[model samples]
Target: MLHLRVIAPEHLREQVLDVLRNEPGVGNLLFYPGVALLPEGDEITADVARECVNDVIRKLKQLDIQHEGAITLHSLETVLSTRAHHAEEAAEGDAADALVWDELIARTREDSTLTMTFLLFMILACLLAAIGVATDSSVTVVGAMVVGPEFGPLAALAVALVQRRARLARQAVAALLIGLPVAMAITGLVTLGAEAGGWITLDDVKNVHQVDFIYRVGPISLVVALLAGAAGMLSLISSKSGALVGVFISVTTVPAAGFAVVAAVLGDWSVAGRSALQLLVNLVGIVIAGVVVLVLHPRKSLIPRSVQPN
Candidate 1:
């Protein structure tokens, strides 16, 4: 369930209340007259089932409440009331299968931002992967994959493409283009320094076989990437965040970038090229799969014809 708060202007008060009253998934509706000062409107709140969130929000948006007033959605960790339970049961689908489009867009938008923390995670993950490649450590490579932050922007890119959100698409692309190369360059320099300090011998870095799967691209790689992308997007939509950890570790994107840089530092151009290709194939497959999943998501209209936009 979600807690919905709305501030409706004087003229639209009845319209807002009517919609909430008619919505079967809404319970505990509370309206406070003239409670809003900043937006200068009446305040309305309701306990709404998660399954009906997208539909309710769409109707509210059609009313221009976002421009004239405000709308806020909050997650409810626990709903103890019988009314809330009935509301959920009355809604069209299960909360676990709900597709909250606005929430997803907001989440992906935030994650795609090119913040310092994001870059730091990318660099650290790649560095860990470089060490894994140098020592032929599959476990360390898996750890690096789990730590990689690349999936966020990749997911954002897919969402942006399907939604036709130009700004978000640009942000996601820029983050990927900038983040990956920067991480690679930093990792390359560190690899060179490690070799100089004898922390990693040339033979140790060159004799990588157990983790060669990081650079080896095959038909199965694309299949796995597609599967992971769909699962990741579905998990995001259903808020099954624990599933995302598995999605993160299933792809070889971070490991490929790390391996490519380490190989380049060792003057292994052939291996570096193959590693880069592996990275590209995984990225493209994930984006393509994510777009398809989002486009095919079940979004049957739950709004009444009267409330829906013409």
Candidate 2:
């Protein structure tokens, strides 16, 4: 369930009440009039089922509450009230199957932005992956995969394409296009420095049998990427964040990028090319799969007719 806190303008108070009161998915509605000093409006709060939140938010948006006042939502970890149970039962769909698009778009927008912290994580993840590749350590490679932050932008890119949000698409694309190459270049330079300093050798790069999967691109690679992409998107929508760790380890994007740089530094063009191909395959497969999943499960169908825009 979600707890909605709405500050409605004086004139729109009755309209907001009508929407909330008429909805079968709302429980424990509370209203406080002349209590909002900053917004100068009435403060209304309600506990709403997850399946009905999208419609409620849409109705609130239609009244321009965001502009004239404010609307805030919080996920409830536990609801003990009978009314809450009734609300969920009365909603159109199961909570797990419900898709809250506004929340998702907001989340992806924040995650897709290219920030200093994001770049640092990218570089660090690649560096770890490079070491794992050099030492032929699958464990270290897995750690690097979990550490990589590329999936956020990839997911965001998929959402942007489906939603047709030009600015969001630009942001997600910029993050991916800029982040991966930057990490690869930095890792390559570091690998070269390590080689010169006697920390690593070309033989180490050539003889990594245990981690060779990072560079070997095959049909299965695309298939795994496709599955991971779909799983990741579903996890995001369902709010099953724990499932994301499995998604992270399932794809070899970060490790492949790291291995490509390491192989290039060691003067193995053939291995580097194959590693790059692996990275490309994973990226393209994930994006395509994500787009397909989003297209298949659209948000419009979940919206209640009473809240849909005319």
Candidate 3:
């Protein structure tokens, strides 16, 4: 089922509830002072039903006596009407609150010029990527990818764009800039160490030349990064959190970072530069695409409304 937020003016609430109660598609209505949730429908096939909801929301906003109620709709991932679920429900609220707090930490720029968390993430991501490349293991590569803190900035970029928070944008950009270099450097060092241990060789660097990773910066790369970015933004808006992991794998950011160090260690300057380019291209594509998708989603009122913490 789908979820909706309806806002209405104080005096017209009775009329609003009357209309909502009689609304054919609406299943269950939970009345509140200024806002309420309604089970929109079980059958949502195409654009027609969606338009109907939007139209209803628009009409209700007009009758808003005290405040023109803006209507927002979202997918309902789970439902628990029981009292135990209610206590358990607070778990999601706590987690969301924690996320908001973390966002603040990530978004806030320290006056000291560099943040410890950013630096730590960069170092950690780079080291992990280097280990993966050295081992030539996809498992390790994925670990490195997941370890890479780039996702935070990427998500932050979307949030910044949606809220028009320039400070957040700048902070995210800064994190990317500092994080990439630090990560690459750490991997470079790791690569050098792996070389000394005879784990990775110049042969591996040369092989990377023939390998077609996402960093080639062609139309396909651009398209994949764009799709990943859009999907990432959508995941954020819709609260389908599983998609976030897909976002990491969908883009070439982590792989490029790994390849950059491998190339650097083998003195394959060409490969290093190309991988760097690939990283930059993917990052730019994801950021721009994320910004655009968020802008579009909010306008369509497709973004899930963040509930106020009660």
* Candidate number of the best lDDT: 2
Which lDDT tens digits does candidate 3 get at residues 1-310?
Answer: 3466555545566766665554444544666552333322212111112223443454565665225444455545565544323333322222221222122333333321247876776677667666555555566667666666686687676667766778777877788777778777777777778789888897766654224463466778888888988887666645556997788777768778778878777888887788788888888888788778755653322223255443
- Computed on alpha carbons, the lDDT of every model, listed in order, comes to 0.90, 0.90, 0.60
Q: Give the TM-score of candidate 3.
A: 0.59
How many clashes in candidate 1? 0
Q: Please report, as a residue range, the 10-residue window in candidate 3 with the lowest summed lDDT.
A: 40-49
* Cα-based TM-score, every candidate: 0.92, 0.92, 0.59
lDDT (0-100) at residue 164 of candidate 1?
Answer: 95
CA displacement after TM-score superposition, residue 47 of candidate 2 (Å): 1.0
TM-score of 2: 0.92
Model 3 off-target regions past 4 Å? 1-118, 208-215, 298-310
